[model samples]
Target: MVEIKIALVGQPNVGKSHLINSISGATLHVGNFSGVTVEKKEVEFERDGYRLKLIDLPGTYSLHPYTPEERVTKEFLLNGEYDLILNVVDSNQLQKNLTFSWQIADLNKPMVIAFNMYDEYSKRGGEIDTEKFFKLTNIRAQNVSAKENFGLEELFKKVIKTYQEQNKPRIYYSEIIEEEIENVREKIKDCRFDKRFVAIRLLEDDEDIYKIVHEKPWFVELLPQLNESKQIIKNEYDEDDLKEIFFEERLALSKGIISQVAKIAKRETLSEKIDKILIHPVLGLPIFLFVMWLLFQATFNLGAAPMDYIASVFDSISNFVGKFLPDGILKDAIINGVIPAIGAVVMFLPNILILFLGINLMEQTGYMARAAYVMDGILKRFGLQGRAFIPLVSGFGCSVPAYMAARTLKNPKDRLITMLIIGFMSCGARLPIYVLLVSAFFAPEVQGNVMFAIYIGGALVGLIVAKILRIVLFKGEPEPFVMELPKYRFPKIKALLFDLWIKTKTYLKKAGVFIALASLAVWFLSSFPRENIVKEYSLKIAHVKSEVKKEELKEEMRKKILENSYIARIGKIMEPITKPLDLSWREDVALLSGLAAKETVVSTMAVLYGGNSSNSKKLIEIIRNSLPFTAAVAMIIVVMFYSPCVAAMSTFYAEVPQWVWRIFYTIYPNVFAYFAALLAVSLIKLFS
Candidate 1:
């Protein structure tokens, strides 16, 4: 089959990845771009007897690179191999998106423009004449909505046609800039880049381009002419920075072309009406809190039914495995260690999925951007950039990506501050622990409210800590907030399901390896050093004549064996440290094990408890009856404020290189959690 390689590029939040996902039969592979940490995604699919490979470059605002991601896009466009450029433009924000488009058009490659999110734009009475756009810029254009999967087939067809014709863009700048470009282009001799492109970059004083061409044989000849051309442009534009002058030139050209092709209906958009209340300074914060509370409530309450069903399913599997295998070490490990540990973790899948669904919906409907806007003022007061809200909110889902999301904050101090406090947001892995403890301790009616309080409480504490950090460690004026609020539209069910499927697959995949191994290790630690206690207990039970006496002897023997186990011994060693929180040895072990991954806490508890009982009661029931109210409260608080999993810490370390900050990030949160839990236990005990 014929293969067409297309470079997919767009600004941030322009639905570039969404468009790749919308295509039928596309297989996606994700990795880092060569020599950089920025994520690179490539999609492959077959359409109309042709195999297409789409390289989804990092979303960048301009070819003048600002962030690492933007540099990746710029480098790939200039040097990387690709057949054609598929520029995805946000239809509603044409002027800004088109400015970037003009920069890419300077590459002089086969190109097609996709006006994405046209569905939302059209709903708000915005119209784009694609034909007029093509006539003005001499590039094929398609009005498409990647969300609704409309016009994608036509868009791809145009892409193929453009490639077959070997068509390139004919974008022109103002007369004065063009005159300087021509003069520099004439002097440029043996450079790999298009002369026009080199001339423009030279005019803008691009250091990267200058470095490249400076090594060329023709540099000695070109330097004098390049300086003269730049001087001429600077004089004509009456500006010191040629880059700014060139930027304004592109902006003006974008505006002029937008006027010719775009017809604004000039009506009040639904997003605007909703934002008045949702983003109101007085009401927005409360509304955001209410929405978050509702999300947790639904995650716990709605997920309960399926959670029970999953638990029962695992119970059946364990029973079946028990009957199928003979009573031995392998059987014991599978039934007690592997089955229960994995089952405990897997049972919470419904809760994770439900929470992700809510987050995905907020993102799809454009509420997430408004959420950032709403929180910017509050976050700014705490010395975090408004953009930090994205990563902070994302921390509620997971921290690995949350750390990456911190890249949006351009200021280093702000990004580091945001990364440090993200651990307090309480990720989904910790939700199962909360659900277990809350269900065991609190009444059924208030369970959801209690869960909501835990999340909100943690977030509030995170903000306060951010404020403290700003004052003590990295004090500065917060970066100004500049964000785009996209128009709201109904989320497509297909897109939501696809995203959820990926999340579910990722969770299960992790469980199969990481959770399974951790569970087996816990089982070994708890079950080992098997002495002759079983034989001794059998002898005593045999000697006892009465049935009640024999059963009581058996129960006492089981407790003794567990108390003598290695896990219990280790827990005892750590008991003095956790004693202030009123946590028992077993609870101590579980919490310690949680440092690896939060879900392991539940798994650890399951193995520790389920090994001693053949009762039909669920793990939650057993835990509820086992722990006191104060211990449960203390455990919840500790988990809320403690250090995140090893993976999240590694990600943070990778993002921030300073050894001192890494050491601080490692030591501080755990210390904070310990004292917080100690205080919580003391207050509860005093009140009671």
Candidate 2:
């Protein structure tokens, strides 16, 4: 079987991911591009005696790279191994998207254009003549809706056919640009890229292309011609900026070609109509808040419906296994430590899933863009732009990705400030901690509202801190925000379920592996260095005649062992720091364990508190009866404001090179968290 390597390229929000998901039988592998945080997605599958491998490059608006993601795309297209380019374009944004399409077509590779979102376009009476498009650019084009599963098969057929014929794009620019391109193309020698590509990029003064061709032997001759050609084009076009000249040339070409090959849609777009109310200055913010509140309410109330069953299942398994195993360390670890700790974390999977599902829906249906636009006004006041909302919103999912998402913001000051406060947005990993505390402390009817408030409070506090950082540290005006608002559509259930399944698999994997190991270690640390204490107590319980008194003595032995345990000793060292926050040794250990991963906070608490009759009670029940309400509030406050896990911190470190900023990022969150927790405890004491 022959393999056809295809590069999938498109601008952001052009349904590129949806196109990949719609491919039948395609297998996907996702990772970061080498030495960069930009995500790389590749799909492979057999189709009609050929194995097609597709590399989904990060979305780039143009070959003139402005962001790291765009640079990644440009670098891969220029140098990565690929047999053909599959450029995906939004059918509705023809003038803009096609301008980029023309720029990529200059690469002179075997290429195909996929006019994605044709369903939406056609509904408004728009049409594209694919045959005419081919005649105009010598590149086959298809009008496909990845959302509706339209033309995907035909699109792939064209891809394979283009590869078999080794057909490259024959796109041409204006007469002046073409003449200069030929002039520069003549001097090019021993170049890996197509001569025309090298010439055109040179005319545009692309630094990346310059770096590549400068070392060539022909560069000495090409430089003078390149400079002269650029001057000629600028003078002819009456534009000083060579880059702008080329951009306008491409834009003019796009407008000309689109007019000849496509019929414009006549209807006012539904997205524009919806935006009137959704992005309205007065109502947009409140509507966004209401939508978010409802999502959290669902995350808490709907997700809690299955918790009892999950808790019971784990209990039954523990009891059944405990009956057979001998009274030994392995049995104790499995029953009292690993099983219960994992159960405590696993039971919150529904809450995490609901939260993720809500986020995915918002993104898929395109409300997230509107939310960003609505928030831009507020973000600007804090020295951030609408683009910063993406990473900040992603922080609700996880900080590692949120930190990576910060790469989208071009300004360094905006990126750093957004990253610094992502921890305060409270990631999904911290959900279990919040849920555990809220369920234990708040009333049943108000649990969802409390959950919503926790999220809102964290976000509000994060905004305030961003303002402070901007005023004191960054001290600059934010860049103006411009973003494409994709049309709203019904989310495909299959895609939503697939995304949920991925989230579910990831959460379960962490529960079964990382959380289990952390629990075992926590159990071991808090269980041992007490053999003498245990042996001493065992003697007393053994001598007792009354069954009730024997159980009491056993409970006493458990407490004594826990108090002398290694983890407790470790917690004791932090007593002075946490004491003012109304935190005890167990809470101290839980928070400490949380530095590794937030899920471990609950697991550590489960291990610390699961002593007597734990097998018969839920972790939440035990926690509710054990800790005071004020301590729960303080723990929640601390978790909300503290430094993120090691993975997120390392990501921040990697993204940011300066040690001074890294040190500030590392130390400020914990300092903020401590004072926040202290204040919370003090306020509660005064109120009570």
Candidate 3:
């Protein structure tokens, strides 16, 4: 079979990733692009005797990149290896989407257009004459709905046909621009790219393209003519910015071609109708909060349903293993260390999944954009644009991806400020700690409300910190926020399940491996150096006559062993700092282990408090009885504001190269967390 490599390209919200997911019999590989945190998705599948490999490029608006993700797309198109370009367009927004389509046409590559979301368009009485479009631009087009999975096979057929024919875009621009392109094209000699593409990019003053052709043998001669061509275009268009001129040129071409090839439905969309109330200036923020409150309520209540059953199952496993393994370090580690610790974290999986599902539903249904729109006004008051809201909200899921998502912010200062405060967003990994404490301290009816309060409170404080940072460190007015809200559509079951499956897999893997290993380490530290304690306890039990008193002495012996264990020593060193918060050594250890991952805080507690039994149900009771109400609130406060896990921290370090900012990012959150915890403890004491 002949092999063809296709680069899948599109503007944002045009269903690019969905299209990839819809491909039948495709094998996918996901990884970060070289030296960048932006995700790269590639798929390979065979169709009709041809092997097709598709590299899904990041969604971008134009060749002139405005964001880091956009630059990644542009650089790949200019330099990455690919045999054909498959540009997906939102059929409902042809005017806007086609502007970027025309820009890609200038690359002069073998191209095919997949008018994605065609089902939505067709339902609304829209039509696109692909034959006319092909005749107009010499690039084949297909109307495909990646979600509905219609017209996809035909789209790929066109893709393969375009590759077979070596077809390239025959699009032309305004006469004046064409004349300039011709002039610059003639001067270009033995260049790697199509001369027309080079000429156009030069006219647009593309810095990346300039770097490429600056060292050419004909550069000295081409320089003056290139300048003259730019001047001619500027004079003819009556615009000083040649880039603007080129943008308008493509935009005009988009309008001209779209008029002939498309019949756009002029009726108001359902999205607009929904946005009327959902994004109302006066009511939007409250509605958003209510929605979040419901989500957390469901996350806590619904997720709690399976906890006892999951706990029972794990308890059975631990008991079975205990019966089989002889009493020693191995058995204690397996029973107390690995089983219960993993069980404690795994018990919270349902909560994490419910939370993820809620967020995914908002995103897939296109309400996420409206959320940003609603949040933009409040964010601006806090020295952040609405765009910063996306990453900050993403920080609720996980900080690693949230930091990566900050790439969408074009301003370096905005990106930095947003990332710095993301830690305060209370990611899902931290949810278990909150749920555990909230369940232990608060009444059942109020637990969900407390969970919601935790999230909203963190976000509010983060915004306040953002405003403070703007005044003291990076002072500037926030950039204007402009976003296109996608048409509302029902989320496909397959896609939603795929997302949930990935989340479940990731959470399980972390629990099985990372948490288990951390628990083992905790177990070793808390279980060892027990010879002296065990001997003393044996003598004391031997001297006691009553069996009940003997058991009491045994329990005392266990606590004494834990007090002097290696991990306890470490926690003691930090106790001076936490003493004001009314936190004990065990709570201190749990918080410190959380620096590795928030989930481990719960796992560490299970290992330390559950002692001999290792049952989550018992662990919770022990915690409620062991810790004071003030201490519980202080623990929650610290977890909310403290530095994120090591993975998140390292990701921040990688994304930010400046050591000064990195150091500040690392140190400030912990210091802030300590003070916050102390204040919470003091206030509770004063009020009570």
Candidate 4:
């Protein structure tokens, strides 16, 4: 049972990540640190005879008790049971850094202040009396550069010392704050927390924190009185408002501390002065578009060659096995099912990794916050705050984690709306659909561009739908905004790999299982003998006369397919029901059965028609060449806007409660997808 944990805490964009990378000599993940998508990262290293575990917490300006991230930071320091907390701070911004140090100070956890960016501090003419910092705070503080890998030996030594220290001092708030703390302490004698931290949260009116107070036996009598006192105090000061009060105080305090400890010679920093072109509306949108265009370009085009090569490799393997093995069910299983299933998943890896690298690039450079800032006005009309841009961007990596990112939004309604639209953002999971669709529907002109357009198409439609839902469903003014825009910096290479690893893990976890199982299921369905209607008639037609007549009959077999297969029988049962969808039995069967996992149609086509190779393309050409254009539209629209597969449905239900209004979750968008595709198909025919 030998184990130890250390925590890293800092204001946003200090060298917290830099320090971790230097200390562990391992890649440390860097992202906007907040929400449940947020968590402390732990990496273990053997440094000088002791196993060192470093946990990186979410960034915050202060723990003066507001915002989910601040709460998460505070709770982890107290709950994560770390032996030491590395209070990472900007050497150039000493005062604002102190607020986090002071807050962790209250937790009384053993900690070492790894004063980061000493070079930045010195260049800015900042001089820190590290000894004075310790005298005021009673915690060990050292100036070190996470960027240069300087002072890590001393940093580790202090870390080891903090771990071994038996007499670590417990700190508290001013007597005024402590008196109320004592009352909460006596009441929470039965509850848990660093008695002092709970008191501060109670003072600041944390809704969840106060609820915990009322549950304590001794506090039940005092809860009402305590709440009354808080209200009385709230009336006296604008300071205790529910939003950003702690943040504002931290900013003010940090600015004050910066002047005393850090110096700036008034030379303009690189990014702070870049507002003229980058943030200007005409120029800004175009630049943002260009940047993202490059991102999607790199993700698709750069990855496509690799993607095609991988697809080709899987195709070759399946064919090689089929040619070598005897004609039997086992060969069918190996060639048709197993290979395609693995291919379905393997093709996505390149795109997922590249897109994750792009998003991580944005997050690390602090462009993410800027993107949100620039888009806020436009995003507001859709029932989102400026910050919703972060989650939407994250969806390109994976939607489940993107959904988790929604918790960062303060408004619950907006968070739910973000989650709902996120799945439509064209994740790497959707890329296989694009690969199949573009290859089938059009020539290879601008293949990456076409795939990129499809991604934008889904995002555009998702946003429009979200705006409509917002207007008709949850109409209200969105909350005001105050987002931290950390100064842009070079994205660390290690952080990029760490991000790639995280997304790769998520992609496989969510989509891999279904693709694998669906491959086998589809092969099983394909291996069975054709059923009563189509099989009977296909057999009946076997004895036909002329070569010309046989060719004509073969062409007509698509009709026999409708009359006779097991899939056909299932479709006919629901045909009268789906006619508004302009769906023929072929489309209907594919739609109904494939609803559980949308990719099933792709696998099913390969199995039902014959080999999944370019052979799958011939099946599509046959359908398109015969089935009315409207039918093709119905198929595309149905899959695009339909109820997401079972996984998305389960997530929606789990995240959202079952209010009567929840019927829209089950019905509205689905019927909309059905008819939209149907109408588009009809319009195409009518125009033709």
Model 2 worst lDDT run, 10 consecutive residues: 506-515
Error of 2 at 543 (Å): 1.6
Model 4 scores a TM of 0.76
Cα displacement (Å) at residue 169, model 1: 1.2
lDDT scores of the candidates, listed in order:
0.82, 0.83, 0.83, 0.65
| Residues 42-149 of candidate 3: C-alpha lDDT, one tens digit per residue | 899999999999998988988888878888999899889999999999998898888998889888899999999888888888999999999999999999999888
TM-score, one value per model: 0.79, 0.82, 0.82, 0.76
Better of 1 and 3 by TM-score: 3
> What is the per-residue lDDT of model 2 for residues 43-121, given as tens digits with 9 covering 90 to 100?
9998889999999998888898867788889999999999999999999889999899988998999999999999888
Residue-wise lDDT of candidate 4 within 169-218, one digit each (tens)? 44444444455557655555555666666666666666666676676677
Segments in model 3 whose C-alpha atoms lie over 4 Å from true places = 385-460, 469-477, 506-513, 535-547, 575-640, 643-666, 675-688
Alpha-carbon deviation at 74 in model 2, angstroms: 1.5
* Model 4 residue pairs with clashes: 95-257, 96-254, 124-263, 126-263, 533-564, 534-564
* Per-residue C-alpha lDDT of model 1 across residues 1-688, encoded as one tens digit per residue: 8899999999988888789889988898866687654668899998778889999998889988876678889989999999899999988888899999999999889999999989878988899999988888889999998888899999988888898899899999989789889988888887778899988888898898888888888788888888888888888878999889988999999989988989875554577888889989799989987887787677667877797888788889999989999977788788888887687567657766776788788878888777777777777788877668767876887775577567656656788899999999999889989988888889999999999999999999999999999999975554556666777767778778877786666555643455556556766776676668777887888888999898778767756665677777898998988888888888887886786678778877776675333342487788888888888998999999988876566567766768899999999998999999988888888888
With a 3 Å backbone cut-off (N, CA, C), the pairs that clash in candidate 3 are none
Model 2's TM-score against the true structure: 0.82
Descending-lDDT candidate ranking: 3, 2, 1, 4
